[model samples]
Target: MHKYQKLNIQKLYQIYIYLTIRLLMNVMWIVLAIFLIILIFERVAERLGIDRWYKLSSIGWIFLSIYWLSSFIAYLDTDDFVNMLLTLLAAIFSFIIAFKIIIDNRKYPWKNITLWVTISILIIFPFYKIPILRDFLIDMVANHTLFILSSVFNASGEIITDATIILNGFPVSIVIGCTAIESMAFFAGLILCLNAPLKRKIIALVFIPVIYIANLFRNAFAIYAYGNQLFQFGIIGTAHESFFWAHNVIAKIYSFLVVVILAYLTFKIFPEFLTLIEDIISSFKKDVDK
Candidate 1:
């Protein structure tokens, strides 16, 4: 009887955690739009030199950071150590910036952060909630990924109409994140918003398609790695070590470096954007020196 009660408590705790995480994730999606609007207004106010806007904007930033904090807590449950760490770091950065804004509430700082983060989130957030758009992108990614796996890699795989790939007895579902839509959206939004010439913007925006193709290849590689049990050496005593290494660690590091490189290349094409970034840093540093 005692064991039964203890088991019930454990299951109840799991359910509570699951519900809390899902609730937080859902709220973040809804609030993404709110933050984008606030930041857009703040950006305009900064351009107009309205110091009063900082008061409202800084508060909004503090509130908006709940998204990152929530994500950090959610990843703790999934055992995604890398993502959990990254989200914690992001939450810290966001809160630090918010603290600075609050301290120097009248001073106009975070201009570039206002520009880039808002644009990126605005572009990326909608697709997550919009069913048709999410499904379309996920489906396309799964189709091409499976096709490349079958033809180029000579891997055996079949995609369920529901966007799951059963490859080499490993079933991996292709979600919207796997489609690389977020990164593509971030790149497209940043380039389009930059104060660069139309020609330069066009050139930088070309990276979007490049990113899409690269993401397709990345997904195929992950499928190959997992399906072939490339990292299933059982070193971690997990039967799914192949997937954990491929999708969580190796693929993530590769994707992060690739995005950083692509963003750097875009900066080279947009000198004004780089200057804006430097100015944002200077603003933060000035507050720190105070």
Candidate 2:
């Protein structure tokens, strides 16, 4: 048996994060929904040239700040430094954006960004929480990946369950993130939230399924490499090493390149939208300089 002792507020804070983690996450999504509603109303008000509804966007931006701050704290208990740092920066940037939206004497389009974040979160958070939807995506990816391994690559593989694919003796678990939904959601929000022509947005939307197909092949390659233990050698020693090299290093680089190419394609298709992104960045930079 172990002993129970009281701790300081600093230590208590970390413990509370995971202790009430489920509640924290529920509140986070509820806040996000509220903000999404606000942003939708704000957009409508802007179109109708109304001030009161549009002014509510300041609260939406603050909700975004709170959303990311909670995400940052949730990740603090884990060992994922990269995720922690990125969420921290997101929280800070959202905080700053909220204030900028509030003191908009000159008026900026930061509210558009709030809508984008809201859409992205709406997609990611729900897909993560809702079991039926999440499982379907995971199953789709896993089954297709197992098929690719067995048929395309001529590798021996089997689907043990909806989310588990076994190649040879090793198993690979497929999560919702593996379905490329996050990437698709981001690009969906990107195409919809930005100032782009209707025709161009439709064209850009085609890449969502394209990314999913491409991700199937990427997942196939990762599973083949990791499950087959292809890199069981010096330096790249075990299953973990094979996973890191294939999934983390190689797959990540290619995935990033794919997104970059698609972004450049968007630039070509909707040239003025690039200007919109530039303005979004420079708006903050201009304030920082001042």
Candidate 3:
């Protein structure tokens, strides 16, 4: 037999063993995370310190739990069209990644996490912007986020646009609970889950809101741009599309780029954060190795 064929057979055997073990361990991890989350919630509620932190953590945990549950349910409910489609997609992607990992002999098993995160963000971002999906998730997120923000800042929190938060008296509005936040959190959480460094996770978390805020300011600035370009100078109807395009697509993409920049900056400026993240990775590595 050829060397490559031998390697392939060995890899296939290793994958079979790994998958069998992973099925059991995955359940354990899910159960353990759930138990710890519940314990943390009880402890936080009992001893009042940083109520906002607890609320945020609670929201995070709840959504995570639901996500896990939904994914599991999705696997089982093969009869429904949506469920079957989702399951098929999941299977295809999972198999592709698994095969790639086996063939590539990657140092870190979790390296494909970024790919999965990107896929998830692409799936979610469109839904977040589309009218029907936007209304549903935005309403839920905004209401929950507004309740948290109001309780924390004691402001009249109301969502004006898709992500804009309006304070009753404040002239400038704050943007909260947007798709940007969801996108960041998803990517960050995925990195963290994949046993990436803590600094990257922190960078991801920090940059999410930065993107949202930058977009908000961009919108505000575009208002001035529109007024100056159109009303103040010449009333060119066709030229006004420049203002609209600037306000819509360009600003949004630029803000996303800012988030990418911030993530890069976090790694450069706060390099030590990686040590802490590596420690976490080491701990998990120890467990997996054992």
lDDT of 1 by residue, 1-290 (tens): 69999999999999999998886657655445555666658668778987667455455556557778878888989958988998888888877777776665444336445556667776776678789888888899999998888888899899975899988788899988788887887787778666678999887888988898888878888889888888977688765888889888888888988988997897788987787677778877786798
Best by TM-score: 1
- Which digits, one per residue and each the tens of the lDDT, describe model 3 over residues 1-290? 99999999999999999997775445424433433453346456547663333222223223334444556565574323443454456545544433433343332332324233433444455554467776665555555555655554344545676555554432222333333555455545444544456665665556556654554455444433443443333433454544555454455567657757765675564554355457546645655697
TM-score of every prediction relative to native: 0.81, 0.79, 0.35
Candidate 2, residue 13: lDDT:
85
Q: Predictions ranked by lDDT, top down?
A: 1, 2, 3
Q: What is the number of residue pairs that collide in model 3?
A: 1
TM-score of 1: 0.81
lDDT of 2 by residue, 60-175 (tens): 55666777788889888864455578788988887787677776654446656766767777777777888888888888888888788888888888888658887777788888
RMSD of each: 7.5, 6.4, 17.8
Alpha carbon deviation, residue 243, candidate 1 (Å)? 1.1
Per-residue error at 224 for model 1, in Å? 0.7
lDDT minimum window of 10 residues, candidate 2: 1-10
- Candidate 3 regions exceeding 4 Å error are 1-102, 107-133, 136-183, 194-204, 223-240, 248-253, 269-290
Ten residues in sequence with the least summed lDDT for candidate 3: 52-61
